[model samples]
Target: MIVNQFLVLGALLFSIGVYGVLVRRNAVLVLLSIELMLAAVNINLVAFGAFVDDAAAAGQVFALFVITVAAAEVGIGLAIVVLIFRNRSSANVDELDLMKW
Candidate 1:
């Protein structure tokens, strides 16, 4: 497959992720959308790393870092979601106002 194909796929996936984040009220769904966006970014990174001739392997390394960050994000995000559910009994994004004074 060509780099352009991967780029287009990534763009499509990212767009869907954005739509899910904007339209969904469920915290879990929003987190899943964020994961989708990260996956799209990873796809683009790997595609470019494979197609480019620089041989520095920076793109793959950066992708790995992004994966690590994403894992942490999921862990923290789920913990927050669980806490919210325990306190409020709902995972709806609109209902979360813990930061509001």
Candidate 2:
């Protein structure tokens, strides 16, 4: 139950997420990488909140907010990706240049 252990885990998760986002060209994979990053941030928030001597559950509450935002982002991002795939027939990030008019 060490805070440092949780921090290390969070850092590892964040690093993996960053690698996924940078290396994957698939739009869906990018979304998943973003979710992984958010999850890492939530882990840090909850770990700090549990270790700190604060009366209010600020870290947990903020984690909840991040979850909510992540949900909305996933919904909107998937919808956009779907639309792009439907129109372009491909979900590759490198081929999705919509502003090339």
Candidate 3:
């Protein structure tokens, strides 16, 4: 029962994140939505690892790696967003899609 609830909530969070990414145009907003989706995946991983397997911690380990990567991604992504704003004076992803080489 608890697993099912956790799974449902995770799915809902992921769906919300997808919706936000699709509807929002700001670069920072889209990045935050992506982070939300990643968080939902981590939640499901930890919940299942805790409830189903007490010995193997693969899910938890994966979540940790994901968190680590997400942190790196946020740093680089924010720096890029700031660079874009400095160059274009706008942070909207749609407007900034000039395909930089």
**Against the correct fold, how does model 2 do in TM-score?**
0.93
- Provide the TM-score for each candidate, comma-separated: 0.91, 0.93, 0.90
* lDDT tens readout by residue for model 1, 1-65: 46899999999999999999999999999999999999999999989988884678877988999
* Candidate 2 weakest ten by summed lDDT: 92-101
Kindly give the stretch of ten consecutive residues in candidate 1 with the minimal lDDT sum.
50-59
Best by TM-score: 2
Report residue 73 deviation for candidate 2 (angstroms). Answer: 0.6
Residue runs of model 2 more than 4 Å from their true location after superposition: 98-101
RMSD (CA, Å), each prediction: 1.9, 1.8, 2.2
Flag the better candidate by TM-score, 1 or 2.
Answer: 2
- Which lDDT tens digits does candidate 3 get at residues 1-101? 36988899999999999999999999999999999999999999998888878676988998999999999999999999999999999998889656777
User: Candidate 3: misplaced stretches above 4 Å?
Assistant: 97-101
Q: Which candidate should be chosen as best, given lDDT against the real structure? A: 2
lDDT score at residue 94, model 3, on the 0-100 scale = 82
Which candidate model has the greater lDDT, 2 or 3? 2
Writing each residue's lDDT as its tens digit, candidate 2 over 7-89 gives 99999999999999999999999999999999999999999999994899999999999999999999999999999899999
